[model samples]
Target: MTAPVAGTTPDRPLVRTWLYAVAIATGLAGAAAVVHQVTGRFWGDLGAYRAGAVAAATGDGNLYQASHLTPDGIALGFTYPPFAALLMQPLAVLSMPVAVATWTVVSVVALVAVIGLVLHQVGTPDRHRPATTIGALVAALPVFAVAGHLQVGQVGLILMWLVLADLVGGRHRRWHGLGVGIAAGIKLTPLVFIGLLVLTGRWRAAATALGGFAATVAVGFAWRPADSAWFFSGGLLDTDRVTGDPRTVLNQSLAGAVTRVADDPTPGFVWWVLAAVAAVAGLAVAVGQHRRGDVLTAVLVCAATGLLVSPVSWHHHWVWWVPALLLLGGHAWRHRHRTATATTVGVWVVLVASTSWVLAAPGGWDLHFTGLGLVYSNLYVLLGVAGIGVAGWRLRQPTGPPRPATVDTLSGSQP
Candidate 1:
């Protein structure tokens, strides 16, 4: 079955009203919990970001060299680019509770905005779009995560929103691709989007992205020369900044899986080989979707590629799956695969609902896992790999040629 055109589905006002009510209740409750946790985590990721900015702004010490200990004894330092520290300088100015509260609200709004953006790109019509989006978010509760991230104060959703806006909403604009470059400056994962720009034949945008990224790098070097040099030179290689140990269950990257399976802390040749293969395969899937004229799916796969190939894809980074499944379920629903879609949604709910337990599994013991423990630990990575395979398999061997792939099929007004 072909995908449904925008006007094909009828809307139900009662359904929309109920979903809106549920969404508001659930979102506020979730935000409250997230804010509470963030407030309690004094030396957590927000702390790192704030501390890093205060260091850079107040000249306390080297941003790269500084480290703070958590209550549990894990040593974390400011690991993001110098540009990020500068950008986050506001965090250093606000009181901790106010900063955490404000950040939580901003993150929640960003995630909802990202969801709305994805739904728009997926061609969900205005009549039923709101219900469909809130329904999906409520169903995928963790991904909804209204006011905060499960990982506490991560900027991944904001970056996702920035990239999606550039790709889908700004497709026709000359300033396209600039958001992605700035995002990469904040966190390097979105850098893969520049390559997606190149492969999808947006060469000028690619150049603009590269130029924007270069400008950020130049700014970093200008403001914090020594820290910038250390980071750009070798500090980036130290995975401990973001991902302490590759073998840890929280690291759901291809290299992480390989290291856990191979029992190597330093994960050398095999990890590289696996990463290379996954990157190539995932990018191939993305390019194929582009050729098929589905820029939404193409951009998402490129995002997935970044997650899969990075040295350590923290479990929270897996939130990208929310928009992904929205698109995928749309395809399946239009195809009338009701049972398959239900099964997919059920699996997602079960896995994510148990995330608190799974995340807590690494608490008492060393990170080594075996047997089903390995599967339990790497479930997200496995699911991501499976998602790439399914996406590739769903495409026909040949569709209409590169039909000027654009993300504007039924995107309403920009979110």
Candidate 2:
């Protein structure tokens, strides 16, 4: 007799797609109501309009022009190459609320699409459903918290997608560089992936990324010489003014966390040490796994490492980790036994479910809720630490022998 299966696999992909559609829709609807309920929301919305207005009214470069006055301008404002504003400038003409709302939709869509693409790449057909479902579920919580910024045409989702693309398209080295270039041009942090490519001996990728970086800078400066000067010399170099704002609580990065922990001590040295160590360790892991050709693993490793090691990751930024969670969760569910996928899934589910409630709660809730939020936050941190530990453990374990490839009857490629 055939061996009995443990769990039934339903039509997971369709179910997953449907679940996410509902979850994201619900999040948007809820946020709209919350924004409407806040008495001072109009004022806040107006403020956003004014910023974009100031940016659009004065010139194409107003927001950027302001950044040039500061040192970190190069790194802030999406820290992307100048081309990012190409699309955003038009939004300036619309009412602030309209512009932001439209952009949030785009970001949400991009995030979902990217995660879906990654899931398809790494998962078996049966696994896709759960992976996508979990992705949507995790995304709803973090994306809602960071909804305010998404409305402003921020590129976090886009950047995260591009990075994931790099890992997924590893077999196509050119595509890897292209994704990295696009991401770096949109945001500087993704350039860190260049370091990873180099460590992996993908010299071509490094060269392509570097060339793209230089080319964009050259073209951006060529297009607007004055703005470029301000952006490069002053804006790119300074982080103090860019990061000084107290409202950037969502960053929740190491630097931001330190700031939260103590109002005074700068702790600059500690933050640098931590970031450097993370980058080095993470790059090492990615390079070691280079031969595996698992794009999902590379992307997750990079993102998780960045969040854990960065000094100022906010909860919204956690949205980037959704794919990582899904990948881990899907892998676990697929294996279900030998791997710690179930444990990983449980950890992520608890963290995400609790986080949404705490984040969405209006201030002055009961002490019990407040206490629970604190406990949950602590739990979130611990899980993050534990995740890094687990990833490190997985990395140390030898990569299992390659699975036998099943020939795809349609494409002739190995599935």
Candidate 3:
């Protein structure tokens, strides 16, 4: 028998094509499922946004005071910043059906873009067909969660893309922090990236983020002074008003878990303590990854930390896990040790499976967890904790002679 030729894999391209075909097919199916589930109905959250936008554009009642109802008759109110309402003014010009359809399409596109971004950042080198194919397949694991967000016209996917774009483009752009700032203006969660930038010694980017955020605030104040004052003076701090109940099964933040288990009026204190510890440990790991030239990993760590520390993190907000899973899976696929590979891939499998299950389950703030429900409700927070633990473990491992710390733009030859 002839020996296999070295440095050649003839079937690799064929395998890659097959993988791409499967991923595309699966994504289309997921989109179909979302449409079937939603059936072109008005989205509850998007209704609130639309109402706010209409109010802002018409100079009617205060945007914050505008009351909207979901198709199901649930009372919904605008909870985002004044700038978010201003940004939605264009949608207000359209009829309800048209606005919902347009927003849904945009959201679906953003979801696809997020998947492509993760694959590009964590997949094998551009020259490695097999690795890239595997990355695409891994990227599909979170499609169900993405579809859930799309069905409701949730903004999580767009926010995820904004953060990823900033991280991916920051190395090449002078004003890298602008995207993050704009995203934070729309929703405060993305402000966490600014802290990550500061921790990573990207002071210029941090300043840019602050400036962009300030500009948004200024625009809001100039355009609608009373609404801007309402948000900044009190609305922003009223998590209960913006997010409903922390005990909601959909809220997977550390605070949510605490709220579920603790009945004390002072549970907020406990959450604060836990959040502080998580922030310190998670940010420390992020700093270490940055110093090791693994900027992507560091960013994921910080993103996960943000989810955990937030007062309310809906299940869709955990979309950051898409990139987290890809990064971990890629590392596992490249490792030399079978045991390590199995363990890493096992974690990815567990997380992906659990996320799908949770998204499918009936969830509400009034619901209480028992038995498996506890695990299901706390899945994302546990994943965040596990990610931080993995970072700490990596820090302890013996390292080769340190190469000069340089950003891993996540663009290079295959490992």
Candidate 4:
């Protein structure tokens, strides 16, 4: 066995303290901005969230009736659950600068937490753990998904943190499903975690998740009855809830790729067939990984499945890809002696981290493209598909791999 590295775990408390000080200072700055009613022209997705919360908090307008224009000059609707708006009421109180500042700070903290938890899940050596997580966080800085989240003040980071903490932290076992439930309330994507809990035979936690979700819906209805009713009745049921054209490269879902390939505004039958295949195959692989003591892989498979199945998966929505890449890196390192597997995983990691394929593509992302354009536009979609295939293959491999440093300890801690 390798010996521990110097000046690593011993300095954790100092690193943690420094992190706390930064967060406190940032929070104080945000509070000052709110008190002074500071304003700026930093319109982005956070503006929509703030506006939605304003409507929800002040009842100035209908939440679902019409899209609201922000200082940034875009008419965007609040495309999240009522509970999310309720949670963001604080943003309604914040100025644009404060909102952005606070959000950036929060997103950074969550990102760090996610990296640490993921490294823990994989049993990264304690000596290398801090540096690895810090390095991973720095590496994530330029990734399109992560950068997009910080730029637009998206909630993806916070939601990812909630799920990982509840499932992998080993600190909240008694309240296992609460975080998943709350995250699902904020955005519907995390609902997949509840299914994961069920599949993993964590029945009590799954029920708690559903129960928590029900409570959120109840709160939404209580606070804004008509808005909640309308949202759940139509917006949640149908595919379109201000989601842009499915053909756009911004949409990295399987449906997005299918629409582009078939040149259909709505690639109905084929999209469903492919989605169904992905769901079955992906879920099976996830279950296999979980049973084989690889809970992080299972979680990532579920995350990737949600991205593929959703009608719209914006670049920022791929935040969980951070952890996915970490796992891929670990796998590549362990299998370095095996040329094919190592090279494949290493190349895949590069592809996953590089955002240039989509960034450098020609304009008119919504318009149809031929030949190489299709590859550029559908890069992430294809990656998701291929990732599932790779996972399935790994599951079936007969190699007696080392037992995973899985999250079962955390799960088992749940009462």
Task: For each candidate in turn, give its C-alpha RMSD to the true structure in angstroms.
Answer: 5.3, 7.8, 6.4, 5.2
Instruction: Supply the TM-score for candidate 4.
Output: 0.84
Q: Write the per-residue lDDT of candidate 4 for residues 229-300, one digit (tens) a residue.
A: 888987776556556577877778988899989888797999899999888888888888878867778888
List lDDT for all candidates, in order: 0.72, 0.54, 0.70, 0.73
Better of 1 and 2 by lDDT: 1
- Number of backbone-clashing residue pairs for each candidate, in the order shown: 0, 22, 0, 0
The count of residue-pair clashes in candidate 3 stands at 0
lDDT of 2 at 377: 39
- Residue pairs with colliding backbones in model 4 are none
Model 1 lDDT per residue over 1-415, tens place: 1223568852354345435644564555465556556656542677778778888888867997666567767767888889999899898898655566666556655666667667666556666766676677566556422222534567777888889878766777888989889998998888899988888789989988899899899999999999999999989888766765688776778888888887777889887888899888899899888777777778888887888888888776777777777776766665678876986686577456546534554575336778977787677778778878877986876563332223432224532
Error of 2 at 230 (Å): 1.9
| Candidate 3 global lDDT | 0.70
- TM-scores of the candidates are 0.85, 0.72, 0.81, 0.84
Candidate 2, residue 370: Cα displacement in angstroms equals 15
> Highest TM-score among the candidates is held by which one?
1
Once fitted onto the true fold, the runs of candidate 4 whose alpha carbons sit more than 4 angstroms away are 1-43, 66-73, 170-172, 335-362, 398-415
For candidate 3, give the lDDT of residue 359. 44
Best by lDDT: 4
